[model samples]
Target: MAKVQVTSADKTKINTYTFFLVSRMDAGKKYYVVSELEHLTLEADSSKVSRDGQFVGKLVPESGYELPQNITIEYGSDVQKVSGNLYSSVTGEINLKASWHMLIRAKGVKASDFFVADHVKYQITSSENVAVVGTDVEDNATWTVTDCIIPATVSKDGKNYQVTELGEEAFIGCKKLKSITLPAGLTTIGERCFAGCVSTLTEMHCLNPVPAAFPQLFFHDTMEELNNSSPVYDCVLYVPAGSKAQYAQAEGWKNFGGILEDGEIIEPVVGETTDSTMTITCNAFEQATGYIVKVYEDAAKTRLKDEYQFDADGKLRSSSFSFTIKGLSAGQTYYIETMAVREGYYPTPIIISQNTIEAKTTGTATANEGVTADKPIVCVQDGEVVVRSSGEISVRIYDLSGQSIVAGKVTGYGSFQLTKGMYIVVAGDESYKVVIR
Candidate 1:
């Protein structure tokens, strides 16, 4: 039979505290045994074992002896033994498993120990270290810190600082920012950073070339700055003298057109004039080819003035045509409107005159001397009347019931033929009874 010993060692005493039979078996055959023991130690070097108490090693039996057959090992309260034949010429080995428990401790300082001030301008370095200056910040104002990277370089002039990035919203909404000096190394601007800043930032100095994606909202120097859609014109854009063409092609910056140079002012288009003579002069008016000018008393009236064509120079010579408004009664008001016309093309018409000049008679006359009515009851028809007048004069007719019969206006010597009726004839404020048959 073969016998195995189990022991528990205490490091404090440097000696074994418990001992028991670990396993037993008959020589030359295999056997199985199960046992449970705590705090067991092997004769091998203990330091090689893990802190979890697991053991990995071969257990060798005496030389020239075979391991027991049918052998099984387990752990519990007592050591166990099983029998089986073992060969004397064979050697055998065994292994055990166990575990150990341990505790861990933390090292060094906490994050909260490092503090940063609130509500102040900070110049963050490439390493992300932040330094606060003060808290008196201007509302909606942006400030840029140049040469942000540590170990920054200086220009030959030694007067300017270079930076690689425009900090987020560095100059956004600075309603009072009249000017800004940008570093040459700047490559990109952040978003929504400069909106609502139209009132401020009259000028921006780009010491370096502007980045390709320079923000569109940034109103840099250009003519569009002065001609912006806003009804209020307040500022002028000034760009590098020779950069007008390049900036004009830039996307958002193009809104300010190119920078204005000396003697490059463009005059505005003048509107057409409206006067009693029905004459108009628009400086921008082009000499419309095959175009005609039309004048009308009113849209509802089919009557139209003669059409007149413009000369090659677009000048409508006063003698080219004259509008004589006939069928107009003295002391009567009339409206006149004029329009430019071309076949297949209709531009806005120029209102030569609206609600203009009164038509007045040239001569005066006496009353009743030229009035006659053959019949008493005046029948209204197509607004005409008949009356016998002595000498050149004007005539108006009214029915017997005192209602105006003929609203037609007339002047000069004439025998007025009207529908049969008795009517009151009125000539320039003088009334006379007459009959038309």
Candidate 2:
């Protein structure tokens, strides 16, 4: 057992804080005490604690002190004693805990270990600097790489693989990629990055322009048509839903033949009654593979009910698909429009001419004979009037006619400013007194 004392020294005064005494100790015998100290300085004066500040320290018996043994110094915190032997008459260990300015060592992380998942598929990370040179990727195999600049020197050894690039592709003949996930930061796709891959590829998510130097193999003839028409791509390009119109108008990206808006699934327009057969026709000059027709009760709220697929020859003629509308109620009105869906062509399938039709009774035979009075001939908005028949026809201006006027090829809606008035509208071999207001 031993006795120890703790103190605090101010500028000019020494204060004895605490003391403890040990028993059963001889004059020649001695003991060791371990102490830990912490300093506290006051920035402002407090009511209970002195403004002069205090020096905190702890003392513990060191009779069994050993290397790497926990020595309890304060009531809450403890310190470890590392020394091997403690002298009986040795003074207590002193720990100085104070605030001192010192520079800290810099911290860093080691480079990540990277290796290609499959030799057929190269893997590149954001920090990689190597070039990928390998065999042609299998058609279904997926090649994933990210955040690396793949120089033009790299070449794809094989075909029909999926090549995802987070950066620009400066190389040529990487066409084996059947599908690609373009990086948002991508700025350009070098020429032929996807050349000779058209047949194997089903889609391309291009975020930037197809480099001008790239060969036509990168895209089909239909995709190249975007330069003259809209920025429509040749293949099915899936974009963020609801961005069809925006993407359709993007520079060098328009003319996506079939721009499907978000959440919209393009299917063939199936007639309501499975028993009722309908014919779908298109006037597209190019050959198409499928035809999509939309059936709607109201023009504004339209949806796809059915889709008709066809072979290449279907594009040249009126391709007909018949479906019986089994449960459709007779006399219900419906609208129909058709378009062409073909491979290597875009803005697909063409938007077929649309019209309204009515369902008839199952056993009844109905024929569309001719135009009746109720459905009079009318001019379409922004459309010109042309007379195909060459026969004597009577025509008169609604408000400016005294005698009967003759009718021929009349254009511009027949008047500059059509106001609400009674007009005598006549055509070859027929006459109809009409009123325009």
Candidate 3:
């Protein structure tokens, strides 16, 4: 393995450190193919935390080279090797390397103007010197392919250009799309790109270990809506070995079936996550306008537990930040899932998994009908379940399965003593799963 040096950013002080890469384009390779290195991991000092939860403050080339804005550096915020995108690690070590942009003509191309080359359809995005791929009603009828490989460069009009953006709805409803080979330069995948092929896509061979973003949505409108049906990409997403973690955290990259790196399976690819929080980090963290974090219940996701959203105001953390989820349902597990976000919004996906973080403070109360209560609501404290409301109200205790374990009625205030354990208490419309010791 070769070594590279970059500076680090600490929370309250200025310090310099080194980082390394996690994956390469080919096996036994010492140098990186710039295209394949786009999302390569940049390892950080394990004993390091960013001055702003990131290490890219002064992270420039050790001697010369430039760290372009498009380039990303990912590192594990912890020893687990779960890398944060765009040098967005809070711990551990990972590096993200991006190369030059493919230019405008590489953005999107229409299928109606398709050009055929090597049994694959192609279209030039124009005189910008590159070929692009895009779709509107994707005339898959003209070219029916069950398995497809998009070459790094396609020939058109006696000229060759690199393949970049995979246009919006590239294969919106292509049921026969069993597998696809995306080139290393694919940066943008338009909305609803894979609208209805969640089941048929068995394998995805992505030459790029990491790119700018990925936005794969099915028939559902939003991620939460999709969560109500399918929580992850059923197909296995294959990428370069050692780059699984970066792919996992890239926008809309988490798939329940698995994100495969060099044939090995890594289930539920996600960013850094803890019991009660999911963190979103990236080299482009500074460029993000803002972010939205929504959490859903493990079962019947329609029931939204709570949400946290923030804009990229000056108050935001510099490197990476974590969302502390609240309102735990008794016996209920919350998955810190993300909505299918667009590429321009943010760079990566949150570590989607079970939320184990607990909240001790009380939150706004909701009645059985979801009506807000301004006064006291419900909370678990002093080995008991406390319910308070300004008007007539009731409380019910349910287990993880939604089966009512106990019930209580109260008009003003009531406290039900409890044993040592956890319970889901619903006061009015608001519900909270809490622990009492």
Q: How many residue pairs clash in each candidate?
A: 45, 43, 31
Model 3 over residues 173-246: C-alpha lDDT tens digits? 67777888888877666555566666666677888877546554533335665766646555656687567788
User: In model 1, which regions exceed 4 Å deviation?
Assistant: 1-122, 125-138, 141-161, 210-212, 216-235, 257-437
RMSD of each: 37.2, 27.1, 24.3
Candidate 1 lDDT, tens digit per residue, 292-328?
Answer: 4344444454566444444434233321233333333
lDDT values, one for every candidate: 0.33, 0.33, 0.47
Please provide, for model 2 over 1-437, each residue's C-alpha lDDT reduced to its tens digit, 9 standing for 90 to 100: 32333344441222233222223333332222223222211111112121122222322222332111112222224333221122110122323221111111111111221123233323232332222222223332233422123232223332222333321122223444545544333443333344334444545454333312223323433335424543234545545444555766664445434443322222222222222343322233233455554555554635544444445453245433343333333344445554446544443244322233322222233522111112222221122222212122333333346554433343212332344444455553344343332
Best by TM-score: 3
Candidate no. 3 TM-score? 0.33
TM-score of each: 0.24, 0.29, 0.33
Q: Comparing 2 and 3 by TM-score, which wins?
A: 3
Q: How accurate is candidate 3 locally (lDDT)?
A: 0.47
